[model samples]
Target: MLYPIFEYFDQVLDIPGTGVFRYISFRAGMAALVSLIITITFGKNIINWIRNKQIGETVRDLGLEGQNEKKGTPTMGGLMIMAGIIIPTLLFANINNIYIILLLITTVWLGGIGFLDDYIKVFRKNKEGLAGRFKIIGQIVIGIVVGATLYFHEGVVVREFTNPVSIEQGMVETPAFKDVKTMKTTIPFMKDNELNYEKIFGFLGDSATPIFYILIVIFIVTAVSNGANITDGIDGLAAGTSAIIGLTIAIFAYISGNAIFSQYLNVFFIPNSGELVIFCAAFVGACVGFLWYNSYPAQVFMGDTGSLMLGGVIAVLSFALRKELLIPVLCGIFVIENASVIIQVSYFKYTKKKYGEGRRVFLMSPLHHHYQKKNIHEAKIVTRFWILGILLAIITLATLKLR
Candidate 1:
């Protein structure tokens, strides 16, 4: 909203400072700053409201130190995060841009699902929250919506380098490129990094390829969203880790949207994706600001509300920038958290079936509680996990040049 107003001031009235909004960097900075301000300024009130409404978390006896203390902390603080992100985005981004529109939709859609889950847990007194199948169904529905929009929307397209220019061949100029709709995505650490979904279905006709692509989309969305949801078991774990991931993806979005950067990096150029930088900026700011209250000895918990939206935003942002394939590295914390649960459950079930007694894997699941079982301080565990997330984020960025 503010973007168009500034544009009119700059273009029509020839205002001096309003022209700065034309720069994505400037707008992104504003978005980040605004989002941070919103989160920090309004966060306490939101938490107080949750507390006043008796919307506190129902903590289970996990046997970890300090676990019981968090029993009645106000929950569903994710509303603050959503407000921070959405307000800044609406002010700084081009609302008509398809990518921006999709991201906003992803935020609201998954946020609504998570809010519902949190609602069920707090208001209805259902510790189980929303049914697992229903949660999955919600994710799948959004996945289909996102996948179908990207596949069929005319605005969603990529520019491929058609003519190659090699320095060794004495060609001083860069290659020419053309815009075309494609199902291709960037693969890490590969010579020709682009992989098209159509080629994966070479045996089938072109009509069948989109079906496979949509299925892949659904799988990724569901997996990453759930991974984030599970990772929220500890304070500051999900928000801090997701902030790092969001920053890394924002870099990818900037490069993919810039034609010069895309050519130099030998990556696919996606037009209008620069707008995503603003969204990602808001995302990073929201997460970091939320960390103020969400950190160790937390005043509030984001519950499933924040976790689901965080993962969903990252998934959709990556898909828009063609960096979905890098999610394993970028979201390594969530991936390992998710894998730990899967492995622990599978092994326990197998052992119970074979020996008629359940065998444990880690002292607890989700990876973080394992450290807690080892008597590690919760704050220390969170810090180490955040450091690891930062390392993974760096490695994810390095893939652009490594290829």
Candidate 2:
């Protein structure tokens, strides 16, 4: 919202300070600071309002230590995060950018779905919430929209150079470069790192490639969003881990959007993707600030609203940066949390079918609860997982040069 006005003032009116708004770094910093301030300042009031309204989490009896204590805490605090992200993006980012537009849409779309789910659970008095099938449908719809837009939008294109450039010198002046639209994504730890959808769907022909790509998008959006929801099982786990992932992606966005950095790293230079840095900045700040109230002895829970939206935003950001393949590493915490439940359920069913009795893999599902069953403190479990998340993020970044 503010971007264009300041730009006009700087360009047309020759205002000195207004030109500073043109810098992505400056805008990103402001977005992060403003986002932090908004969440921290408004979080207390929102929590109190929800508490007074008696809108609290309905925690199932998991039989874990300290589980019952969280039963009636104020919930659906993700609205704070939504405001933090959207407000900053609108105020500091160029709203006209395609990347920004898609991000804003994603925040609202998935947030709305999550909010509805929370509403059903809290106000409607239905523990089943929005139904699993309905959630899946919502995810699929957004996935199709995001995939189709990225595939068909004229603004979404990657720059390819005709000549080889040395990564050491990092020359911006290349022999020639062309901005072309292709379903190509980055592959980690490979000398030739680009993976094109055309090659994968060669047998299906060029006409069928987009259909397959969109299917992939649908799967990714569903999987990651669900993964995030599951990871929200404990306080500070989801928000803290997501903040780390957001910061890492923000770094990637800044580098991918810069020609010099892209050339230096020998990576794909996505035109106009730099604007995503501002969005990511707000994302990270929101998550971190929410931690003030969401930590160990939590004051509020993000529930489905924050969890699903966080994962969806991350998924879209990865695709926008052409780094979707890196999700497994960068989002290792979410992946493992999701995997624990899948493994436990599959093992239990298989054991029951074979032995006429269900056997458990972990003491409880979703890794964190298993640790809780081991008599580990929730705070300790969260901190350990965060450390692992940081390690995974470092490895993910290292892949930029390891390739």
Scored by TM-score, the top model is 2
Off by over 4 Å in 2: 162-176
Residue pair clashes in candidate 2? none
lDDT of 1 by residue, 315-385 (tens): 99888888889989999998999999999999999999999999989999989999999999989999999
Minimum summed lDDT over a 10-residue window in model 2 is located at 165-174
Candidate 1 lDDT at 277 equals: 96
lDDT of 2: 0.93
Per-residue lDDT of 304 in model 1: 87
Q: TM-scores, in order shown?
A: 0.96, 0.97
Per-residue lDDT tens digits of candidate 2, residues 1-403? 9999998999999988999998999999999999999999999999999999899999889898998899899999999999999999999998999999998998999999999999999999999999999999999999999999999999999988787544556644455778998889999999999999888996887678889889999999889999999999888999999999999999999999987789889888999999999999999999999999999899999988899999999999999999999999999999998999999999999999999999998999899999999999999999999999999999999999997
Off by over 4 Å in 1: 161-177
